[model samples]
Target chain A: MYENKRLGLLYCLPFVIGVALFKLFPFAMSFALSFTQFDLIEPPKYIGLENYREMMTTDKLFPKSLGVTLMFVALTVPLRLAAALMVAQVLNFKLKGINFFRSAFYLPSILGGSIAVSILWRFVFAKNGLVNQAMTALGAEPIMWLGDENYSMWTIVTLNVWQFGSSMVIFLAALQNVPTSLYEAAAMDGAGKTTVFFRITVPLITPVIFFNLIMQTVHAFQEFNGPYMVTEGGPLHSTYLLSLYIYDQSFKLFNLGYGTALSWVLFALVATLSAVAFYSSKYWVYYAGEKERS
Target chain B: MMSSLIRSMVAMGVIALALGSTVVSGQELRFSWWGGGERHEAFLKAIKLFEAKNPGVKIKAEYTGFQGYQERLTTQIAGKSEPDIMQVNWAWVSAFSKSGDGFYDLRKSASVMKLNEFTDNDLALGTINGKLNAVPVGFAARMFFWNKGALDKAGVAIPKTWDEMFAAGKALRAKAGTKAYLIDGEGYDMILMSHAYVYQKYGTPYVDPKTGKIAMSAAALKEWASIYKRFQDEHVATPLPLRASLGGVEKPTEQQPDWVAGNWTGNYTWDSVIRLRGSTLPGKGSELDVGDFLTLPGAKNSGVFGRPVHMYAVSKRSKHPEIGAKFIDFMMTDPEAIRVLDLSRGIPSTAIAFKQLLKEDRLRPLEVKAYARIATLNRNNAITPPAAQFEHPRMQKFMREVFEQVGYGKINADEAAKMLNEQGSTILQRL
Candidate 1:
């Protein structure tokens, strides 16, 4: 038993070392760097909370970018979740060639966040692109999907929402785990399809839904590729999320200190939101074997 | 287990010894650059010639297209893993090396490098804080290059003055329909063109390098903003929104379909890029012509944006600094190397290479014309070279935003002017 334990420890050492070097070390260094004025060329100078104070007081893009990020997360999370749930429901049906349909739906998610896909998204939403051609064929005036500031965010939001396969897969698994006898009983008692879905299917899948809501919201907050590659946070910076702002400041502008500070704030925001989700889960999410608190 | 560990240790030692022997055998220098196919081919040939001339000194070439080159260089520099030699931009010298220590001081390698081959003005552009950070490859200035085919289709000639250009823009659109514009550019291009117009009329640069402050008053800035607006309003230039719809605002004009189709007729771009613009256009490049530097009446300056095309700098972290310097000298002054490079990197800065290329009649017609025009403008004291601060990315972004706001009608000319004067000063002061 002791030999087995020693071998297990030996096997885990590489992973432990990797996490320490790559993940934990950078995490700690970034936290420390948030207080310094590091430009990657010169040595970092400690300036206390000046970075955070500037973000609040004088950094004009901070508030604007934060608002954009929140809007992006709010718009992306629910729409993506709703899309995943609906698609998962349809895909869960006993239909012919369902596996092919499943793979096709999941394809975008596999290629979604790539730079190439983002470039393709730009062309598809371009003035004389496929979307506009379709509109023209339907005898409608083409919309400036990427050019108009009001419509630009929607283009990226639609891109994010379109890649709902991962969340749908999770939803599909949860739906499969749901008891078939419950649906049969509801059906015999004259429960309508919509009634059975809401009363049985939705309630039972609440745990997975909650899990997905938290995951998707966190993922949405950190979205960089779609906006960075597609719109470049442009058309008057309507799509300039905080992640893009951080990247521009850190890499492009070389304001590593301020970028790190902004990153910490983003981390805190995601953490607080996730904590709130976990705290509120008991109200809506039901596990199979949990006792009633009351 | 102990025997296996000993065997592994012996194998690792053998590998390390092999690597050590290879390093001792010869000096390897890594050289990086960003360019097109022709430039890359020319550079590769030059590198091969240099390697042949210098035995036991191997040159490794790393080349990429223009996109993301700066970002990659930045990360590499920060990590201390940059190439031994790099092709740097003039604007990047100050950003990367403020006190003139970012790159290896070329002045230290004066014995190895033929620094005297370049003119003082050319060398001064690459020097900062009494330290020669890099050597200028060539000089470039923004000039008008028009598509004669497109202009003829619209029944217009290349305009020589500001008012004539505006009239031409309107007339061309009237003749060629709404899809046609006399000029096509991104926001940054429009801002620079507007700066030239304002500078010619007012004799003030956007940023005064002497004091490092915003030089234009609110009224002058308002005129600058107004010129940009008028260009779009008169159908002389494409609006920001419309350009944004055509791929992206960041897309180069040469890549646009309108440019290929000759709907967007012309651009005010750098002389070095004239080859790219001319080559990308239709009809065997005969349709392209370099226009006269357009000026405004009663103007004091040409407002020609003149700078180095690019520069070669040895990295501070390079292990083979002498080899790197020698290679740079060969590229600049060697006759065979110059012949191989030809006019790919614009007109050569060195007198030897320039005379060699000129005597060989290797200079392209349009590029030569643009260079001659810029030289004339410079000789007559008609051009005021923009301060290096004007090319700062942050400053460029701010200027682009202000003009974009004016173009989108989100703000009036006066408001944009106020922002340029007030906010622009604040940003410049910080830098």
Candidate 2:
């Protein structure tokens, strides 16, 4: 038995070693890097909280990028959650061609980060692109969809929102798991369809909604491809998000230490936000045969 | 069993020694560059020829459009995995090859490379500190290029002077209506012109290198802003929003459809780049006319913007540095290599290559005429070295932002000048 246990340990060694080397080591190194001044070509020199101080004090683009990222999260998280829930509700019915609709809806999320889709998004928003061509055909002036600062972020937001299918799938699974007896009991109580939904369906699915909300919020905060590829953080940086800022600093400018510090701030922000979300879930979330926590 | 183990270890040592010998005997080089269709094809052919001539050596090519080449190259450099050979921009020398230690010093292999082919001034452009880091690819000077088809349709002849160019703007608008533009002068183009004007008037560097200060006065800035504002007010150039719509200032001039259609007709770019600019027009290559460098009537000098267009450098970390330097020498000075390259990478940098190209009649008429005009202006010695920080990315951002603010009416000429002064001082403190 001892020999068998040792054999099992040997079998698990590769994965254990990989996790420690690739993931844990990098995580620790990144945190350490936050306190240094590194320009990649030269060895890192320790500067202590200077990177943080500069980011908070003199870096002009930091606040703008943070604000942009926050705005994207505020806009995309709720919109995507609401969209997914609505589509999932519609998909929960015993309707014809429902699987087709489900797959069709989920396709965008699958194709969202692809280069081909990003190129298509550019063409769809370009000044002389398809949408502008359509406007001209309708006897309206063409709009600078991607060029105008006021509207460029909207193009990226719209592109990101179109990838709501993944959250919807999760919602759909949770909806199907919702008890039919609860609906029957609510109906027998002479509750209308709206009342039944509000009291029965929504209450039971609150936990899934909470899960999707937290996940989508985190994903939206870390979103890079849409703003990076579609609008390119341009038209005077109207859509410059935190991820693009970090990328430009670390990769393009080679300010690796500062970029790492900026990332930690972003990580802290996401963590606090997610923690708040979890704490709030106690008020509204429900689980089967269980009372709310405390 | 112990005897068998000893025998296996002896055999493994033999295999290791054989592998080490093979590694030393063969070399593979990686070369990277950015260009249009012509340069990519010509460069690939050159690589194939180089490989064929040198047995036991191979090369891997990496090329991309200019859009993200700098970012990608910088990333590779940061990762310490940059290619063995690279085509570097003139502005990047100080940033990447500071003191020439950042790249392989080609002077170390002087026997392979004929450095005397290039003039002392040309070599100086590629030198950082006392160490020669790179070889200048070609001589480049900015000149005005116009679409003859559009200018003729607007009943405007090619403008000969700055005043005539302003008049041509009016004539074009009068004949072709408000939508027609005399040129497309974005922030980069306008700021360069602004420096040219100031340099001509004051005979001073626009930005002092030692201090990073805006050497021009507020009155000089006002004069610069006046010309900038006049171009917009008179429809000599398209509006900022319109330029943004066409894909902002960074988009290649050749790729814009408006430029191809002769709507955004004229440009101020390096004379070497005119071939690519004209090739994009509806008339293939015949529509562009190489006009005079926009002049302020007998102002001291022409204020020509002259510099090396491109350069070739070897990686400091490259294992096969000697082989890479030999390849660069062949590309730059080998007559067969030069003929194969043609005018793909602009006119050759060396005097010998230029004479050879001229005698071969390989250059187009437009190129011949453009170089001739540049030659006349070079005699005046008005050309100045671009400010060390002038072409740096961050400084270019600051320069572009000033013009953009002016265009947006967020700040006037005097306020813009003050902002530049304050910002320039702050940036210099860090340097």
Query: Highest TM-score: which candidate?
Result: 1
Tens-digit per-residue lDDT, B1-431, candidate 2: 44565578779999999998887567988999999888999999999889989987888899998878988898798779999999998878777865679999889988888899987877888787777788889878887888988888767899877788889989888887777788875557766776676667766555765555667776776766666766777788766656665555555678777777777779878889887777778777698888877777657656778888889999999999999999999898878888888998999888878888999999889999988776665555556667666777667766676777676566788887777777755664443
* A206-272: candidate 1 lDDT, tens digit per residue: 9999999999999999999999988989788899999999988888777889999999999999999
The TM-scores of all predictions, comma-separated, are: 0.95, 0.91
Can you write out model 2's per-residue Cα lDDT over A20-104, one digit (the tens) per residue? 9999998899999999988666778999999999999988889988988898888888888889888999999999999999999
Task: Give the per-residue lDDT digits (tens) of candidate 1, residues B231-303.
Answer: 9999988888998986788688888888888889988788887777777777656788888878888887788
> Candidate 1, clashing residue pairs?
none
Error of 1 at B171 (Å): 1.2
Candidate 2 colliding pairs: none
Query: What residue runs in model 1 are displaced by over 4 Å at the alpha carbon?
Result: A1-7, B1-26, B359-361
- At residue B248, what lDDT does model 2 achieve? 56
Per-candidate chain B TM = 0.94, 0.90
| Worst 10-residue lDDT window, candidate 2 chain B | B422-431
* Candidate 2 CAPRI category: acceptable
